[model samples]
Target chain A: MIKTYLGIDVGSISTKGVLITENREIIAHAYLRTQGQPIEAIKNLIKELFKDNKNIEIKGVGTTGSARRLAGVIVGADVIKNEIITHAVAATYFYPETRTIIEIGGQDSKIILLKDSVPVDFAMNTVCAAGTGSFLEHQAIRLGIPIEEFGDYALRAKKAATIAGRCTVFAESDMIHKTQLGIPIEEIIRGLCEAIVRNYLGTVAKGKDIQPLILFQGGVAANIGVKTAFERALGIEVIVPQHFLIMGAIGAAFIAQDYTQKTKSTKFIGENLLDINFKTKTFECRDCTNFCEVIETYKNTQIIDRYGDRCGKWSEKLPNII
Target chain B: MKVAFPYLGYDTIALKKFVELLGAESCLGPPLTARTLSLGTKYSPELICLPFKITLGNFIEALEAGADTLLMAAGARKCRFGYYHYLQENILKKIDNRHCFYAISQYTPYEFFFKKMPQIFGVTPQKVIYATWLLLHYSALIDYFRKLIRLTRAYNFYDAQKKELEALRIIENVSSFKEVQKAKKELRKIFSPIINTSNEIIRIGLVGEIYLMLEPFANYEIEKELGKLGVLVVSKRSLYRHLKHLLKLDLFDLRTISNAYKYLKDSPGGEAIKTVGEAHIFAKKNIDGIIHIYPFTCMPENIAYEALQKLARDYEIPILSISIDEHTSKTGLLTRLEAFVEVVKRKKFKG
Candidate 1:
């Protein structure tokens, strides 16, 4: 019987899952909107993936993304990884020679530099949204172009109108001014795409020495206009992999595979985790100078995980509780 | 008279020469140890930066080692560092280690060598200056040779530096700037091409708390250790750069000077901000890495670190945050440094 490893990446906007077989082939995958409840989103994902095959046993599970710890606790993940490592693993797996990863999601953008499939330098933007998917989505709404039509409209434009892209505020104002000039919608869309690439280069990708074999992923990978815009700005080919949107999930699955192979024991909590009633509680522990606010996760009166403590005061108490 | 300096991050290999020139019996507190940290924490304010605590610890340890006179570097400028001498002096007085203190103030090092130290200790300025000059010459010679060797080739330059500096510290009868310059020339000529190579290096700037930056043991021999990986490190206390900034702050009123200057105009504390601001410029020039060193309780650096993080974010430069205290492990800092350098190297390769 072929055992599959499950990987879950829960972002603020989306939840992604990938089931990889023993040989690292994608057996089943799911990409769904998170809609704010990560636990419910993951549960729905699990249900959807298992609907067709109930006999497929999950040998290992890994979680990544912003809500990784939460998702880890929810799905009984065997390993947890950060965005940089997870993304780099997946990108390296896809493009073995990938030297750079330019990932632009809805809320954030990250630039990971790799040398021979290993990550060496990396930077991420958490403050601004000028070069991310949300910026394009907002513009698509303003232009009355269906979000799905954004890339095609940009491809139709012959020229791009110069627009300020320092931030969403400046970009929006510039877009309105360009629109008032009666510029063609396609040109404006093209300009927006170009502006996004320009903003990313000038800001988050600034000072970094970017090399070839670049892999651009994230939800925005669906936008061909952005891809074209990046190529024009960088003067290099940008490769968007087939599993761009679910790369993080794929990376998580890869990590799980690596971990499970190293440690023969399966620490998975089994599918019964789906039926477990999990609850959370928060309290302040002022035992030291650092008054840490610790949160405890309970599975029907039994504590399972503890976090949010600056010191390990509360979490240290968990083993005894368990 | 026996004199001692608290080994904060300043290149003590250089200071040892200065001490020899003064004909002073000198000893450095062991490269900031856990015991030193405990002593400092026991006596100092909890909120004060870790560097200050470690320094106070070093001072106490030196005093216990029978040091009667301490060479305290005094700065009366904008940053809290300006008050370090006064605060330390007062605290030491309270602790009653009232041994005599010789201050290296805003006055030139020559003034201290020729007049101030002699006036305070009743030694002839000429003899003291002569001895001091010889010590400084050899010290500078050692430093020049070490830097030359380290910068040029791929070898354990630290061992070479320590060996050369140790040799320089033994020479006597050095006086006057010209003699020191001559000694440097001789040392450089002998070590030139041999020290200078084909090493693909990324020069990194280590800026932040004095303790973590100076003590390789505290930060786990970070700079020298990184050198093992073919990375060149530029710390804030470099003589040429620190002097240039100090002179600019004094002679010409430059716009966008260090914020510490606002508080400690003619003091060591002011140099803290100047050093940080200078580092930002180095980062702009695209230094491979900038590790902002700070102690767990450092207030000024906390403010500076926050601002620097934003700058790094906007500039898209990689920065590793290293916060050290008594509880810090060498292994932990090493892990982060390796991870950070690895990331930076990877980025550069891709670029």
Candidate 2:
């Protein structure tokens, strides 16, 4: 039987999963909108992956992204990691000489500086979505353009107009003002792309050394316009990996592979778990002033996992099952 | 007289005990909560630093709780903290005419011990001297336990938390100097089992504004968050060390102040000088990184932050400077901490 590893990255805006072989070849993958229901997204993702490969034996499983803890419990993952570590591992795996990794996802963006294939420094945007993928998507919709064609519009611009990128609200207003002055849509799009790159470099990557072999990955990397903006700003070619959208998931899978090889066993429940009825309910625990929102997961009306409590009052009770 | 003071993390208990020992009924305001912050912000000047607002709220709450006498620590430095007591007293007087306010100047330890405390509480100088000694020992015990908690929580989260609660209970119950010594021995026993001596643990130094460094609520319990991330935290600012410096008994403070000379030629008021000095010390000690936290709109720590940035660049160590306000979210702070820990760990691995 061929051994395979599974990785799931359940983010706020999207859920991504990948299935890989022993030789790190991705056999099947799925990307779906989370839409506030991560359990359903993971179920559909696993079903889609299973449909592509029949004879593969699941060796190990891992989960990453914002909802990694919830996804880890649902999938019984062997390794649960954060997005920063997973992204760094995945970036280094593909591009061994990658010195800096710039990841702009749906709600957040981060810059990870690496030395000798090891991450030496990193910074994440704090409570700001000024230059993230979601911001670009919003601008594309406002311009009545599909997000997929955003890059093409930028590429067609004769000269990129300068827009204030310090604040999201300011940038949006500036874009509207430029449009009112009869600026071309392509130039406006190019300006927005450049604004994003400028915001990212000034805010997230500030004061950090940016060396050669820079890799850009995340959901936003599909936009070649932003890639070109980054290249133009840094005066160095920016390489976007083949699995840009699913690099976090792929990195999680690699982590699972490493973990299971040492432990010699897999904690994955089974491929047949797609049929299980999983439901999540949340309630505010007012035991203290923190008022932590506790989330409980039930499988067929039986409590399987409980989490999200700052104090492990409810979660610690069912340690046997989790 | 029923005396009250603002809560400064678990150090409030030590202060409470000191006041009680001085023959005054120590009525501490309710442990600082969101309600306290809201009450503070509602009445305080909007532009003032967070410590002023929160402590003002604490005084108001204590006054409402029928405590007639309020003791506020007065900052005599060039920072705005020097005026916090004057403003807080004026505000509290408007709420109640019968309330008594005492501002203990930090610069004049002799006046605080020999004259001001005696005049306010009607205690003899001999008794005041003994009480001050006991207060010093109590604060030291609390500081020592805080260090132990920071270290133990990194390796064993649940056990460390349990032990911390137990230690706090023991410290709070101590009524005399001998009891303080007993509590210290008991804390060592409680913390020893959970302490793991792993060389792989990342060590981070914490510096910045005194109140934010000492009060977990002000900085959203950053030390606890770092501890949970398996990082050994060494925080230099504490009431005990402040007392030691005031009494001219602290050798380390002298070293830290001198170390600041490399970055800052002289003190920038408040704890900024110490902040820069400690960052230099941590860099020299080969600590992995430094976490600098201060209240929003704080001037002194802001100066320290600029100097820290230069030090970080020169020392080749990462520094995470977090400016906290009432609006700072726990999830956001945790994410920054997690990312910083990952960066430090990776850097350590490369070495």
Candidate 3:
């Protein structure tokens, strides 16, 4: 029997899962759209990753991302960590000499500056979604270009046209105006890519050291156009890891491996939980002026988890696995 | 006469007591809610700072509650705070012309105690002095209560919260200087059972604009949330200290200015010097991290942010600077804080 661990990353836009061995070798991986339903996506993700690998003895489990706590409770994870540390851990693990990390996901863009394999500083895009995968996708759809082929158009342009990128509303109007002025489609696409790179540097990566050995990952790493723009802007080479999309899941598996080594046991319920009747209910808690909307998760008629209260009056009822 | 002032977190009670003792009925604005922010935003300029909008909301609510007079603290230089009252009053006048509006200008002790407050309240100068003195002492006592609660919360959060309310009740009704010290001692006793010292706790210092630091509604009750996360938050910026600084009696403020001089040569604007100063002090204390919070679009805090980057580099400590506004989402804020705390915790354990 193969001794393996499970890692699940349920982000805002996508869900990714991986099964890895004791030596940190990925045996199986799956990626699927969360589609605003993280629990369903996670269950389907587990089903896909575990295909024909039933003989594998899962030793541990971990979860990360925006819905990390929900994923943790569903899968009974051995380790639950945020995406920042998880991404940093996986990046530094693969590239020991990495100095900076530029991660642009579906809705969030973050720059993590590392010194000697430790995250010395980090900043994320706050109050702005002007430059992100979702914005790029929205623009792509409006321009009649598939997101997968959007980067190819940018590479084909001879000279990029200028477009406003400080805000999505301005960027959209600029793109429409350029199109109305009969500008080449490729040049406008390239300009949008450059605009995103400029916006990221001006806001999220502002004042941070952008040294060499930079690794650019997250869902947006697939865009060769963005990679080129980053290189052009920073005057430094950017490298995307082989598993850029699943790096966060891999990190979770690595963290779970580290955790179970100490605890000597895994909290993973089993290899398959698709058959379990999982349900979640939410209600507004009016106990205080801060009217928190509390969430309760149930499994087969038994309450498993409750959270989302600021006062912890409901969350603390069930002691955490930690 | 019925009097009202904008809320300043837990110091509202202290202010209430001050007004009541001045031979007037104290009418507090409604507790800050979503409606307060909405009302303020609706009546305010598009680009005004958050304090203005919130204070305007407080005044509006207080007026609705039959408050006859509204007092706002004024007088600042190199900052927009000094201009909030002038704009707010104009908006309020358009809303309703009958209510009395006043800006109690700072940096004028003689005019404040001898002329302004006495004339407003129909009180003697000696009475005003006594009331102001009690206000200072009440805040000092409340600040002490907060310190004990923070220490206790880091170790025992639930108990700290339970005892905090009980202790505040004992604190709010203290009528004399004799009661102040006795009340503080009682607060200590109430929280003593939960105040366990542990080297394992995470220490974070909070520094930012004075309004955001004092108003829980403005910054979203950051101290309590951090404490619940088992973080020992050290925030020294309070009304108690501000009063001392105004009186030219705070030796600590003198040291803060010198420390701030290491990075900022001169004040760029509001709270910039103090924010940089407090952050530098926190880094020197070798805490786990420093959380810098200020309203979005604040100029001085923005200037201080640049200095803090260098400070973070020099000290090699994690600094989380959060720019808050009405639109700042709760989930997004919580996510950042949790991630930061986890990173800081790992750094400590790994070292």
Chain A alone, TM-score per model: 0.92, 0.95, 0.97
Root-mean-square deviation (CA) per prediction: 12.9, 2.9, 1.7
In candidate 3, what are the lDDT values of residues B80-179, reduced to their tens digit?
9989989988999998899889999888999999999999999999999999899999999988987888899899888888887798899887999999
Chain B TM-score for the candidates in order: 0.74, 0.97, 0.98
lDDT of 1 by residue, A233-285 (tens): 88999999999998999998888888888886566677777787777788877
- The TM-score ranking, best first, is 3, 2, 1
Candidate 2 local lDDT, B34-113, one digit each (tens)? 77888899999988899988898888888878899999999758899999988998988888889899999988878887
TM-score of chain A of 3: 0.97
Question: Candidate 1 on B234-349: residue-level lDDT in tens?
Answer: 65444333334434433322522543333334323433454456456666678877877677755666566556655665566777656676666543454356547656776676
TM-score of chain B of 3: 0.98
Provide i-RMS per model in Å.
8.3, 2.6, 1.9
TM-score of each: 0.57, 0.91, 0.97
Better of 2 and 3 by lDDT: 3
Could you tally the backbone clashes for each prediction?
25, 0, 0
Candidate 2, superposed: residue stretches over 4 Å from native: A320-322, B43-48, B76-78, B86-98, B124-129, B194-200, B349-351
| Model 3: CAPRI class | medium
TM-score-superior candidate, 2 or 3 = 3
